[model samples]
Structures are given as structure tokens and as C-alpha cells.
Target chain A: MLGGARSGKSRYAQARAEAIAGRHTLVATAEARDAEMRDRIARHRADRDQRWRTVEAPRDLAAAIDAANGADAVALVDCLTIWISNLMLAEADIDAATRDLCEAIQRFEGQLILVANEVGLGIVPDNALARRFRDEAGRANQAVAAAAQEVQMIFAGLPQRLK
Target chain B: MLGGARSGKSRYAQARAEAIAGRHTLVATAEARDAEMRDRIARHRADRDQRWRTVEAPRDLAAAIDAANGADAVALVDCLTIWISNLMLAEADIDAATRDLCEAIQRFEGQLILVANEVGLGIVPDNALARRFRDEAGRANQAVAAAAQEVQMIFAGLPQRLK
Candidate 1:
């Protein structure tokens, strides 16, 4: 699932994931570096039920997905952009990380719902870092969309299927 | 049509507009405020054939659309986000303007193609102005999509129909 902020992507992805009859694993990418972030993370968590086993994967997401792999597994990565941001902050090789992610996504037997923000539609950022981040985010989304069996873009709670 | 920066939205919209055998009107929202913008506008202009008549509508978009309305008119609004930005900079009432634009779109007889940036998908902006811009842009987009007969979100040059 791909969408802008407040586009209800996470809500849609969660609903989709919950509909599947399987073990629910939420591999979250958010890390509470600040109070606002902590509150936001808490609110998201509140929407999830007890059925979901949370796995904090601010980085090392591929490994987390690998760990959750099963015939009846339903893994919802509550986003890729935050994970990408984390990787960037850690100075990790983004290309290699994205590659690993695609590979993991391909090989995983679970029904995966990968949520990502479509951040490249705005005017070019004033700062170089912001621009670079958008570029990486857009590139990663394209790569993932190519790998996935289905893709949907959420706009104000509406699902528009792309694949 | 709505899409991100360099996501092939303009190219796709141009192709769609060119396909319509009508009096082509390119209602452009961009103004050359700086050298970079001037160059960008020039490059975009070079893509059009001699058939298209240009109308500059940095803020007066509704009037431009009204002027271009005809049974055989093909009007392509190159963008709406930049126009919104111009309105915001001018301290114009965004909601009222959006309402007027939507009304004009509904009343238009032309084969209309609208371009807008989906700017709210990324991490929230650090500044208040950007956040407001994204909010206004998103609201305007939803309004436009509702008014439009068809809506599309372009990604990597591929068009995905939304409505």
C-alpha cells in the first residue's frame, strides 16, 4: 500500500492484513526519538489488536521478515519510508538494503502488505538531504511495486489499485 | 491527473491532451520567478507543438478554464499545486478559490486535463508553511478529483485510474 500522510494507508493495510486467516506479525519501522513520535507510535499501536505480534524493525527489516516467514503468516510492515529514514540516519548502504528487502519480499511465503509513503509528488525540497530522501523513497517504492503481486494507492480512504 | 515530481505526470497529461483533436489550450500556472524556473518553463514550452495556445493562470485559473471552454476545446492545466502556492503567497482564501475552480471544471465543455502534485505522502514538513501547503493541495486535489469525470495517479510514467 502507498499513500500520502493521513491518506489512511496504514488503516487500509491493517484491515487487509487482518482479513487473512493466519499468524499476524507487524514489523514496525517507527522509532520514538521524540515525544511527538512516541505519541504517534502509541496511537498506531492502539488501533492494532492483541492478535498482532509486534516486531520492532527500525532497521534489519529483511531479517525481521525472514523471521516471520511461514505458510500461514500475515506480515504487515507498517511502513518502509520510516525504515529507510532509519537506515539513512545510520549511514547504511541504502541500495544494498533495498536489494535485500526486495529479495526477502520475493522469497517470503507470507502474505505481506508493505506500506510505504509516496513522497516524491511535492515540489523539490529546499534541502539536499530532503531531496535525496524523496529520491530514495520513490526509487524503493518502485522497486517494491515491481516485486509485489499487487499494489494499491490510498487517497483519502479510497483504494486505487495500480497492479 | 495527480503525481509526484518527475513521475511523468506532465508528459502523460500532454500526450492525453495532444490526442484530442481540438483547439489546444495550455493553461500554465508556472511563472518564471527565477532563472531556474525560467529554464524549466522554457523546457516545458519546447515540448508543445505550434497547435497549442498558452494562457498564463498563476491565480486566475477558473477564468482561464472558462475562457478556454468550447465544444472542441482541449485545455490542459499544467498544474494546480503551484497555483495554490501562488494563492497562499498572495494570502488568498484557498477554500473559496478551490470551490470556484471545481465549479468551473464542472461547467467546462472542454476535454480538460488537470495536473496536481500529491505532496502529503512523505514525512511531515518541518515548517508550518509547507504543512499548510500540503493540506491545501490535498484538499484541492480531492475536490478536483470529485469534480473530474476521471482521475488518475501516475507513477514512473504509468497511469493508474482512480475514478
Candidate 2:
């Protein structure tokens, strides 16, 4: 699943996972780095039911997905863009991380849904860093969509199939 | 049609218009304010064959559309987001302009295709003006979409129908 901020991608992905009868794991990539992020993270958590088990993977998402993978498990990675930011801030290899993530998703035993932001539609950002981030995020989205069996873009709480 | 930057929306819109055997008008909302923008606009203009007639409508799009409308005319507004920015810079009434533009679209005697950007998917901007622009752009997209007979989103040269 992919969408803009407040486009209800998380809710849509959550509902998808909740529809399946089995274990649920939320591979959270958000770190409560600031008050805004903290509030956002808490709000998302509040939306999920008690059946969810969240594993924080601000980085090392492949390991997190591996740990969460189980027979009959439904795993929702409630975003990849944040994970990209985390990797950028940590000076990690993004392409390698994305490849590993794709491999992990392919290897997963259960259903996996990945949520990412589509951030390159606006006027180009002014700063070099923001421009770079936008490029990287877009690249990751395209790569992930290619790897996934189905890709949907959410806008105004509506899902449009992309793949 | 709506999409991110360089997402092939213009190409897709142009192709759609070209498919219809009729007169084509490109209702351009872009202004060559800088070298980059000038180059981009020139490139887009070069993509069209001699069959296309261009009208520069940085603002006052309804009038431009009305003027361009004719029998067997296929008019494409290759974008609303830039028009929104132009209106913002001019301190014009965005809501009112959007309403007028929609009415023009509804009344148009030609095949009309509108292009817009999905600008709200990224991390929130640090500046208030950008945030407002994002909000305004999103509002325009939803409103325009509601008025459109059909809607499609373009990504990486691919077209995905949304409605």
C-alpha cells in the first residue's frame, strides 16, 4: 500500500491484516524522535487492536521481518519511507537495505503488506537533502512495488490498484 | 489525471488528447519563472507535434478554456497545481477559481483532460506556506476529481485508473 500523509494507508493496511484469522505483527519503522513523531506513533498504536505485536525496526527491517515471520502470521510494515529516513540518518546503505527487505518479503512464510509514502508529486524541494530524500523514497517505492504481487495507492482514503 | 513530479502525467495527458481525432489545445498554467522551469516548459512543448495550439493561462483559466473550446477540440489543462500556485502568488481566491475552472470543464464543448499533482504524501514541510500549498493542492485534486468523468493516476509512465 502507498499513499500520502493522512491518506488512511495505515488504516487500510491494518484492516487488510485484521481480516485474516491468525497472528498479527506490526513491524513499526517509526522512532519517537520528537514530539510530533511520538504523537503520531501513539495514535497509530491506538488504532490497532490488542492482537497486534509491534516490533520496532527503525533500521534492520529484514531482521525484524524475519523475527516476525511465522506460519499463519499477518505482518504489516506500517511504512517504508520512515525506514528510509532512519537509514539515511544512520548513514546506512539504502539500496542494500531495500534489496534485503525485498528478499525478506519474498522469503516470508505469511502474508506481508508494506506501506510507503508517495512524496515526489509536489514542486521539487529547495534543499539538497530533501531532494535526495524524495529521490530515494520514490526509488524505494518503485522497487517495492515491483517486488510485491499487488500494489495499491491510497488517496483521500480510497485505494487505486497500481500493479 | 494526477501524479508526482516527472511521473509522466503530461505525456499521458498529451497521448490521451492525441488519440482523439480533433483539434488539440494545451492550456498551460506554467510560467517560465526560472531557467529550470523554462527548460522544462520548452521540453514539453517540443514533445507535441505541429497539431497542438498552446494557450498560456497562468491564471484566468476559465476564460482560456472558453476561448480554446471549439467543435472537435480536445483541450488539456496540463496542470492545476501550478495554477494553484499562480493563484496563491497572486493572492487570488483559489476556491472561487477552482469552482470557475470546474464549471468551465463542465461547459466545455471539447474533450477536456485535467492534470494535477499529488503533493501531500511526503513528510510535512517545515514551512507554513508549503503546508498550505499542500493542503490547497490536495483540496483541488479531490474537488477536480469529483467533477471529472474519469480519473487516472500516472506513475513512471504507467497509467492507473482511479475512477
Candidate 3:
């Protein structure tokens, strides 16, 4: 599921994943780098309850997914946007990340639910750096959409199936 | 200027605009529809210190820019990714948004600073919608980078000039 901040996209995605899978594994991309983030993470964790086995993978998402793959497990990635931002800040190669992600998705043996933020409908940023980030995020979204079986956009606490 | 979450991207952009041109205008894409978001908007206003003019335009960014254009006023867009997400959720034409953003940049008459989140270089999303968003953000970044005079990536609260 994809949507703006606090759009209930994540909740919708989690509910969908829970309905489809017997065993749920949530791969979280967020890092508790600050108190506010830590609190937010805690709230999300509480919201998910104890049914999910959480894997915190701030980096090396492919490896985490590879390790978590199983016939009975449904893997749900809470977000990709934050992970992308982390890599960009780290000065990692975006193409490499794309390739790694695609490869991981191909190798996975079970159903997967990936969440991401849609980030390109706004005004053009003045600085080149922010602009580049937006462009890269857009590219990543397209590649995943091409591979995904279903595409949904969540807004105002509602889900609109796009693909 | 960069900061985590609410860290000073908008404030810095506004300050930069005020420094370059005494009178500054803000292009706000966030819709204040909920208490949380309303709080966010209020915080942004408080941070701006009353030196800047604000224009709340949730969509049709090009028209907003045109309406706010002036010879001596600097234009500052608080964000781009959120606007893009809004469009995606609304099923708005992504191509139109891209075209309009580029046109606005090409025709901008004064200094402008834009805020955006880098959303590529992360784990591949499992669903089609997320993948599409990542791809679109990437493409948008490339398009803007190709056209913009400068490009930068903000990481760890620091700016890295890419172009």
C-alpha cells in the first residue's frame, strides 16, 4: 500500500497481510535514532500486537528478507521510502539498491507486502539534492509496481486499488 | 538546510528566501485536515517568524507559483514528495504534475528553494503500487536534476551538492 503521511496506508497494508498469511513477518526500515522516532516505533509495534515477528533492518534489506523467507511466512515490509532516504544520506548507489531489491523480490518464495510513500506530485524543489531524492524515489516506485501483483493507494483512511 | 522529520528543511528554506529577498512566499502542499497535521501546520507557521507569506495549495502547484510570483519576492516550496503522494492517491496524472513542475522551474522569476525527501536506494517494495511510486520519484528526480542549475542530497543533517 502507498499513501501520504498518516493516511492509514500502513494499517491497511498490515490488515491485508494478516488476512493473507498464516505466519507474518514485518521487516521494519525505521531506526530509533531519536526519542520521537522511538516513541513512534513503539506505537506501531503496539498496534501490530504480538502476532508479528519483527525484523529491524535499517540497511541490508535484501539479506534480511532472504533470511526471513519461508514457505509459510508472509513477509511485509512496512516501508521503503525511509530506507531509501537512509541510503541516499549514506551516499549509496541507488541503482545498486534497486538491483538488490529486485533480485531479492525475485528470489523470495512467499507472498510479500511492500509499503512505500508516493512522493512526486508537488512543486519542483529549488535545490538539486532534494530534487534528486524525489526523482530516485519515483524510479524505485515504478520498478516495484511493475513487479507487484497488486497496487493500492491509500488516502484519508481509505484504499483505492490502482493495479 | 536539513533536519530529521520536523528538523528545519522548511524553516531553512524560508530563511534562505528571506535572506535573498526581504519578502518571501511559501508554497505549502500539506492539507490541514486532521489534528496532527493541523498541529504540524501550526508549528511551521510558528517557525516562520511572520517574515514570510504563506500560500496553501494542495495541488495545481504551477498555478500557485504563478499566482505568487513577483520580481522581488523569493518563492519557497516547503515540500514536493507529499504533493506527489497526494496526486498518486487521487489518481491525478503524474505526467501532468511533472510537466507543470518543470515548466514552473523554467519560468521561475526569482530565487526558490524546495524541500523533498529522498526515497530511493531502499529495499524493494513487495507491492506494485509502492514500486510505481519509487520509480516515479526517481524519474522526477532525474528530470529535475537535468533541468536544475544545482542539485543536492541532504544527509545526516548535512547537504551534499550533487550538481
Task: Quote the TM-score that chain A achieves in each candidate.
Answer: 0.99, 0.98, 0.94
Per-residue lDDT of candidate 1, residues B1-163 (tens digit): 8888889999999999999899999999998999999998999999889999999999999999999999999999989999999999999999999999999998888799999987787656987688778778877887787788888889899988887
lDDT score of residue A97 within candidate 3: 83
CAPRI class assigned to model 2: incorrect
TM-score of chain B of each: 0.99, 0.98, 0.87
lDDT of 2 by residue, A1-163 (tens): 9888889999999998999988899999999989999999999999888999999999999999999888898999979999999999999999999999999989999899999987787656987688778878877876787788888878889997877
Instruction: Please provide, for model 3 over B117-146, each residue's C-alpha lDDT reduced to its tens digit, 9 standing for 90 to 100.
Output: 556644566667777876776676676677
Off by over 4 Å in 1: A6-152, A156-158
- Ranking according to DockQ, highest score first: 1, 2, 3
What is the Å distance of residue A88 in model 1 from its true position?
A: 14
Q: A83, model 3: CA deviation in Å?
A: 0.6
In angstroms, the error of model 1 at A153 is 2.5
Candidate 2: how large is its RMSD? 6.0
What DockQ does each prediction reach against the true complex? 0.22, 0.21, 0.03
Q: Assess every candidate by TM-score.
A: 0.61, 0.60, 0.51
Q: Which of candidates 1 and 2 is the stronger one according to DockQ?
A: 1
Error of 1 at B85 (Å): 0.7
